[model samples]
Target: MTAPGLFVSFEGIDGSGKSTQARLLAETLRARDRDVVLTREPGGSPGAEEIRALVLQGDPDRWSAQTELLLFTAARRDHLERTIRPALAAGRIVICDRFADSTRMYQGLSRGDLRPAVDQLHDLMIGTEPDLTFLIDMDPGQGLARAKSRATAEERFEDFGLDLQTRMRAGFLALAREFPDRIRVIDGNRAKAAVAADVLAVLEAELS
Candidate 1:
């Protein structure tokens, strides 16, 4: 029988080092001779990348919460169809930097009332969830500092200020609780190597 594909996702607030950790995990798994596909949401596929520019650029309010949700779901659908699903079907390990969880956190915070819309849309259009999700948890202050240091046009989301980041951190923690089976919270305030080590430990436990 063909073995099922492994789908892993890394999630965290801006500057929580999720992207770096995701890359490290991908490299480590590859070193072990595993078929790994390291990708990111909102832009994993060509069409999704185009949507990424639209959603991540411009002013913070460039798109309303509802509109942004639609755009994100669109991108996610494309990414899944063009990149994620294909890799998974081939029995490759797929590691995504961010996934639908991000849309839930961001849009849910933008307008607390939009949380339902986000969840409902996800259920309808994006039925798949990650097999494992690593949430790099950290203080919003520290995370904002890290994010500001590497500011770019994509600052639209990061520009939401410290309060929003703090709230989003809470949102993520709540999500971890809600999906305890799939979400693993990692302390991200440590050194990169240390954090990556913890990430590997957690992932290895799952794999083994």
Candidate 2:
């Protein structure tokens, strides 16, 4: 594997607007002449995207605990090899929409013990570490309400009630505790511009 490059990932529940923030960050980086590559997990590569469809299409609650772990790992393996690795090798700033933490939280929803294994896999596949990982935190109920209003499509995980999402939100907070250096938690209850500004503050401190 190549040496590490500047990598950052945005993580949060379904409706925390991770993608929106990621795009804003990417554009800002580009404006500053930083080579930036924006990608997302469970769907970064072609193979991984197919895995995403499978994982998200079914009732996530019904998917066996082990099945959930394997599917996410499978997608992650492909994503790391195909998308994240190359971009970083080129010295690009990779702003990913979501990464291993998503799996840790979602898998935790099913089986808590799967965390150690996921962490190990994450260490293996994630060749580069984010200088900063903005974790958008939101109340599960509010996020789910927003998610329901925005997405017209159906997915297994999308059908989960607010309770599950709430648990997942807590899981993310716990993850930040586990990796304080890389993870920066952002309150997602605020306005979009406010959230964006908060993220930029961290980036400024890091890049300058």
Candidate 3:
């Protein structure tokens, strides 16, 4: 009988190494002869990718926090229908670079006032959450520096500055408290290999 699919998500402040860790985990799982799908939001699917450009590009103020939340929710819905759900049904281990938690932190703390709305929208639309979430915890200063080191057009969220990133880190931590059973906080300030190993250990415990 085919085993049930496992859904894992990597989340943290921008530049917290979640992306790298997500990729590394996927590689490790595949090396173990597991059928794995490494995907990311808000561009996991074709329709979501189209929305990704709109939300990640242009001026930082291109959309209000509420509007941005809606866009993300729309992209997430599409990603689920077209990419995530299908892969999970096929019994593939789905590793997502950033899932709904990102929206909660980015929009929730960035605007403070919009957090309730973000939660409401999420509950109403994108209800599926990852089975395991790795919150790559790190200092906002270091994280922002790392994020800025990368030259990418998707600077809309990265452009929020250090102050916001600081709050985002705190927000993510608080969020971790809310989902202790599913969200594991990993120290991301360590070397890449070290963080990857820690992530792998967590996966080994949960997935094995």
Top candidate, metric lDDT: 1
lDDT (10s digit) by residue, model 3, range 58-131: 88889988888889999999999998888989888999999999898887667657778888888888778899
**Candidate maximizing TM-score:** 1
What are the lDDT figures for the candidates, one per model? 0.91, 0.81, 0.89
Number of colliding residue pairs in model 3:
0
Write candidate 1's Cα lDDT for 1-208 as tens digits.
Answer: 1147899999998999999999999999899999999999889999999999999888887888889899999999999999988998999999999998898899966446688888899899988899999999989999998998996888888887998899999999999999999999999999989999999999889878
Candidate 2 TM-score over all chains jointly: 0.90
Sequence-dependent TM-score of model 1: 0.97
* Per-model TM-score on C-alpha atoms: 0.97, 0.90, 0.96
**Model 1: how far is 126 from its true place, Å?**
0.9
TM-score: which is higher, 1 or 2? Answer: 1
